[model samples]
Target: MKAKARAHANIALIKYWGKSDENLSLPMNSSLSLTLDAFYTETEVEFTNSINEDVFFLNGVEDKNTLSKISKFLDLFRIARNMNERAIIKTINYVPTAAGLASSASGFAALAAATNKASGLDVNSRELSTFARRGSGSATRSIYGGIVEWQKGINDKTSFAVEIDDASWDIGMVVVIVNREEKKMSSREGMKSTILTSPFYKNWPEDSQKDLKEIKIAIKEKDFEKMGYITERNALKMHATMLGANPPIMYFEPKSILVMQIVHELRDKGIPCFFTMDAGPNVKILCRLSQGEMIKNRLMEDFKEYEIIVTGPGPGVEII
Candidate 1:
């Protein structure tokens, strides 16, 4: 059986900082994200009777470390379908890898879609989200299009994402890719370290929940300024927890700080933009679609070395 699928990467508006059950990929706080059109992953899966083990290829090159993770991910589908066949999976990523771009979210969502199709599982989107969550926690949100809210369920059955808004309004994201190399600390390691050592970590979930509620209201009102304000503050609060850790973990570089200041300058000039960063040095700015080019042009003046991509909301995973 062979199946091919595509899924887009998502940026967390209200971040999912820590996990309650790491093994199951369950998060401590419910998260919300905007799936962007600029970054995505396409995957093809073939389940064959001849192969003895699962194999993975990324951008035409075989990756053993990635294969190990995918193999385990495939087991969920295998166990459900009662299939012993091995799979050959090839993934092509449009987004830069390991640059805080949510590549794994799209990667695993695509894998879950392709593998489920190959195994003859015709599940609903919620079930699909649950399946994807087992691979990467953010993958749950990647299963839906536009603005999605991932409810942090107490267990596997209840944990899934739902679309909050179509995001057809005049809103978009400008991604500033400062570094392409992998980060020193992985999201998982950074999250666990912060959770265990940072006293500030205790209030993160509560603050994130409040942001989630307020942001939802802002989205319903279609108030871009309100949404941007809350998103920026929420992202800053997430990074604050990392700094409070015993052995402080910081994600922002010099360029990241500069970009943040530029966003503030733009806001002061009445451009109405806000910046958010994940577990990396890259910065993403949320602004009105009409102001996208202006923001891009302004960013180009100072950061000539970085890559800036402007994109709007994207659709959910689909079989192709």
Candidate 2:
């Protein structure tokens, strides 16, 4: 059986910083995100008895470094479905890998969808989200589009994503590519260090929960100002926890700071835009779809050498 699927990348409005259970990829706190149409991953999976072991290819090249990880994830499907045959997985990522653009989110989500169809698992979207979570925590939310939240449930069965809004309104993002290189420290590594070392991290879950609650209300009411404020504040708090780690992990590069400053200046000029960052040097500006072009133009003046993409809400993971 063979199936192909596509899942778009998401930017967390309320960040998923730490994990409660590493093996299960359970989050310490619930997170909300908006899937972006600009970047995504498409994957194809085929189950065959002819192959002795799982083989993986990414972007037309055999990827040995990520083979073990993919095989382990595939094993989950095999074990659950009582299947012994290995599979061949091929994926292509449009987003920058490991640069805080949530490439793993889309990558694993696409893989999960394709694997489910290819293996005849026939699980629903919620179940598919949990399967994706085993690959990456953020992937749990990438299974859906628009405003999605991953509930930090007590266990695997309880933790899955729910769509908060369809994002049919004037909400969108402008992504500034500060550094596209693979990050030295991964999201898993960074979160682990912060959880173990950062004193400020103790209150992060509670704080993020409060933000999630308020942001959900703001989204339901269609209050762009309130949503933007909470989104920016929540992201800043997430980064603060990382900075408070024992060895002090800082993801912000010089250009990253410059981009943030420009966003602030734009806001002061009555432009309703806010910036959020993940575990990377890049910055993403949240704005109204109508204002995306204006925001991009203003940023382009300052970031002449960088690549900027304006994106809107994308669709959920779908078999293609």
Candidate 3:
């Protein structure tokens, strides 16, 4: 059997920084994200009786570390289907791998879709989200298009994501890629470090819950300013908790601050926009599609070396 799938990367507006159950990949708080068309992953899977073990490839390279993780995920699918045959998986990414972009979100979403179809499993998006979460927590949201929200459920079966809106109101994002290097501290390590050491992290879940509520309301009303404001604030709060860690974890480079200042400057001049950063130096500016070109042109002046990607809402996982 053979199957192929593609899924888009999602940027969290209300971030999920910690987890209550790390083994199940359950989040400590709910998160909301916007799936973007600029970055995605496509995966193909083939299962046969001839293969001795599972094989994984990324961008035409056989990656052992990535292979191990994919193999573990495939084990879950095999256990559910009660099939012992191994599969060969090949994945190609359109986004940067580990530089704070949601590459894992799209990567595993595409994997889950591909594996499920190739193995002849019949499951809905909700079940697919749960499977994807076992690979990456944010991947649960990536299983849906537009604005999706992941409910921090009490258990594995309960945690899933749903589409909040089609995001059809001319909304878009400009991805500012500052550093393409792999993050020094993996998200798993960073989250554990912050949870154990940062006093500010104690209240992050409560604050993020409030943010998720407000953002959903803003999306319902199609109020870009309200959505952007909450998103920016939520991202800052997430980073603040990291900074309060014992070693004062820092992810923003000097250029990251430069880009953020530019966004603030544009906002003051009556352009409705806001900036958000994840676990890396890159900053994502959420703005209206009408102003996307203006925002890009303005940033290009200072960030000629950095790659700026402008994209609108993307679709959910699809079989190709």
Candidate 4:
């Protein structure tokens, strides 16, 4: 049997900006995301008594640190499968080796989904999502088909991500790769600093809750204007909170603003678009399905030097 599994990377609408428990990878608040077809990763897991330790080949590169990051998740899979400790996990990303795409989303999602099958656990999506959450808070959202929410489990059991919508409607993303070759800060470190030092971290509870309610309503009403604006604002505020931290850390760069302003200009031009960024220089722009082509053209007009990617709703895990 071919043990291959495929998972698509997702961009957060209400991002998981800070973590409460770094060791468990728990987040301070719930987050929602939409899986995108722009980038993805595929992985296969097989038991090999021959191998000494859990091994990982990322895009065919043998990296021990990769295995280390993935190591915490393996015990649960072994317990579920009732198997021995020895296994080899092989993963490949469809995206270029360094695209600044959220590989952890697709990477861990594929691992959880494939490991379940590899272990013969017969677990459902909820269980797999829960398992992935332990590895990374956002990983839970990646298991669902389309728009997904990672509900911050009060403990570990109750909090897990679930599918909220198919997002087959007029929704998509246009990623602006401002500096594909240069990464500013790591997401793990940025989130950690924001949690410990940022004064605004306290305000996140009230502000984010309000933002979440409004965005969900906008999505339900199919109000692209409200949804796009709210998403963009939330992303900006999340980065701003980092600046409030002691020895402040920020994800945005000079180019990030240029890209964001152009996205707003597109909205004014009647091709509604809004941008969101993670810990990298790239910005993922939210736009309607009907406006995807127009937005891409607008981006190309100004940013001939940067990569412009257009993608829409993507399915969750699938066998390849």
Candidate 2 positional error at 203, Å: 0.8
Tens digit of lDDT per residue, candidate 4, span 1-320?
A: 12678988889988788777776666788888999886888999886678778888888898787677677688877776667766688898886436557888888888888888777775888878888887777778888877888887776676788888889888898888877675666787787777789988889866877888888898888887898888989888898888898888866778888888888777777777889988787888888867777788877887887777888988988766
TM-scores for every predicted model: 0.98, 0.98, 0.98, 0.94
Best-matching candidate per lDDT: 2
Off by over 4 Å in 4: 97-99
Q: Considering only N, C-alpha and C atoms within 3 Å, which residue pairs clash in candidate 2?
A: none
The whole-model C-alpha lDDT of candidate 2 against the native structure comes to 0.94
Error of 4 at 28 (Å): 0.8
Worst 10 residues of 3 by lDDT: 94-103
Alpha-carbon lDDT, every model: 0.93, 0.94, 0.92, 0.81
Query: Relative to the unseen true structure, what is the Cα RMSD of model 4?
Result: 1.7
Q: How accurate locally is residue 235 in candidate 4, as Cα lDDT from 0 to 100?
A: 88
Better by lDDT, candidate 2 or 1: 2
RMSD of model 1 against the true structure: 0.9
Segments in model 3 whose C-alpha atoms lie over 4 Å from true places = 96-98
Clashes of each: 0, 0, 0, 1
TM-score of 2: 0.98
Clashing pairs in 3: none
Cα deviation at 9, candidate 2, in Å, is: 0.6
Residue 158 error, candidate 4, Å: 1.6
